[model samples]
Target: MPRTEPRVRRLAAGLPAVAAAAVYGWAHWCLAGPASPPTAVAWLGAVLLLVGACVAYGVLVGGSGSVFGGLLLALALLLTVTAADQTASRPATASCVVREVHTRLQGSLGEGAPSQKTVYRLTLDCPGGYPGELKDDRAVAAVGEEVKVAYDPRRRASPAPEAETSPWRAALCAVLLLAASTVIAGRRPGPATRPRPGFTPG
Candidate 1:
């Protein structure tokens, strides 16, 4: 019975890791192929799902309910799948001309509290003969500045020229997160310990 208990515990602990791998594969599959940005409702749904995942994990890990572990795992899987699908969509590229530039002050003005930052907001004339605006924290450009903007019109209403540089970075970030989580999942959590009475030890 004692040996069986340890084996069961290890098996239970490993299930989450297995699920995580499945999630990684599912995300890759969804994102690797042709994709498009999901609707606003879909985005909202994914956020809600992740929130549910947090709740479900809490219920499971806190020993309030055995069923929630499965729920949490499933929710996480679904969330990642949705994210991958949304991220895989192709972006529309257009040459944009900055029509106006506006600056805003940000951050604290107190001494030694970092300098006040300038945020640049630009109104632009984009492709398809529409007016749009983009904001940048570091870019300093005058009115009538010409720049190329890459944007997913469906996902974002306004396209930032600077943002159109890389879509592969998102995939790369997901891969890195998966790798880090895998490393973390492989380790067995340490057993709980009761602290010894301290002798004023720092």
Candidate 2:
């Protein structure tokens, strides 16, 4: 009976992570489908429900482990939103003429080191005024040059040439995060031991 108890506890602790991953996978699949994605209200409702669930679980569970679980759930929410954004848009190509070209040096400090890189922003004029602008690290087009731009027809937003999303990356990340969250939750610290009364130092 004692042995079975630990197994049950572990499963219960890990269930939330598994559920989160499944939810994210479903969202990604829906976003990638031909049908329209969920409306903003639906997304907001889901977010609210998830947040409420986490809060309720933490309050009811009443353990340090719940803290970690809540954090993981929050992270899952953010990842789901990002995956939706990446998959909701259908890729389309348009030919445009560069109306203006601007260049700037973007710098960042990382790992105690500073680095600088050039970024090129191009204003484009397409037949339908689609993908009116683009930015990239490489100067792929010049002013007055004709170029093919990839964009989302629905949003009319142009993502950088190298910023394309991979279909499997989000799934892989969700799976990995789920595994880590499960392990952390399942292996949560056990109750601390107190020394027996009248026990002297050895």
Candidate 3:
């Protein structure tokens, strides 16, 4: 309740927040520009924010009548859960044939250049594997026929064939954040271990 207490608590609570900010912010700058630092920092923000909230909750609003505090805590927790879900979910992959592949005209960014884009509509029925080179199919599929397709469940819109990219660094960030929050929230000072009044020095 004292001004000094609040100030001291703020200082203590600020260390990790400041560290997370610095690390993740640099990560952002590197990922978007350098292209080798890592692409996981974007997800790291949620973890950092959650850990910070847990620390803040313990310090700024540990006593009664802390409705706003609880709300902030819940919001941060939810953000972390969602981030974990996003990071943990695996991409589903299936193969679809090029029943139809063509270059269609497209426009974007308030410009009219008539861009050429490749679009593929798979013919069904082939199932399992896709045509390796289009000329290896035993029975070529017609417009109304079937074809094989490969796609990701998480990224259904984006097709990745033979794509190799790791998201471990990102998920590790979430796990670390979760662990930090748990530790801070559950931490408690141990009982004093000094000699009692009834005890004598050896």
Candidate 4:
């Protein structure tokens, strides 16, 4: 088959996934109020889920039409959607003081592997009478510093801070996934490749 044919097939396979991402992105903008930072667990779960799905799909796509790929693809897309939703919505805003700062080092052991990176968390006194803590890749402000927080007032007892996410980043991820899915589809075994057990050339 021509190289372009495989690529086109792959892109077609990924169209549904891309459309889903777009819908979630739109819903996020409509529902989420303002942007704040998401919790550590939320961010970690989403990233890990996406990365895991990509790796799993990469391994299983060779099977061609395996349900595993579709399942993982769905999970990854769901994470992407949830991330968008969390990023877009914050019903209320308040000024809070950074009561404390905490940091932790994270990485795995290997030669020339990824180096350890520090994760920062900030404890804040959220407005509307609730205290909250938020996590981020880097500290947005220093301890004892006053900062603005965006939250959903409905959860007055334990309001979660809004995490800022770039729409472009989500778009880029969708594009990359579409490309990867296309490549995998192109690599799938064609109909002619089936073996006949008793066939032989005499």
| lDDT score, candidate 1 | 0.50
Clashes of 3: 17
lDDT of the candidates, in the order given: 0.50, 0.60, 0.39, 0.54
The root-mean-square deviation over C-alpha atoms between each candidate and the true structure, in angstroms, is: 9.7, 7.3, 16.8, 7.8
List, residue by residue over 23-108, the lDDT tens digit for candidate 3.
44444343333343333554465456655555555554344312333333444344334333333323454444444433333332
lDDT of 2: 0.60
Q: What is candidate 1's lDDT per residue for 88-122, written digit by digit as tens? A: 44467777888888889887533322357788888
Candidate with top lDDT is 2
- Count of clashing residue pairs in every prediction: 0, 0, 17, 11
Off by over 4 Å in 2: 1-11, 33-38, 56-61, 84-89, 95-127, 130-149, 155-163, 167-169, 189-202
| Model 4 error, position 65 (Å) | 12
Clashing pairs in 2: none
Shift of residue 150 alpha carbon in model 3, Å: 19
Score every model by TM-score.
0.45, 0.53, 0.25, 0.53
Better of 1 and 4 by TM-score: 4
Tens-digit lDDT string for candidate 2 (35-64): 645567446655765676577445433367
Off by over 4 Å in 3: 1-3, 6-49, 64-70, 73-202
How big is the positional error of residue 88 in model 2, measured in Å on the Cα after superposition? 5.0
After superposing candidate 1, which stretches have Cα over 4 Å from the reference? Answer: 1-38, 56-92, 100-121, 127-131, 135-142, 152-165, 185-202
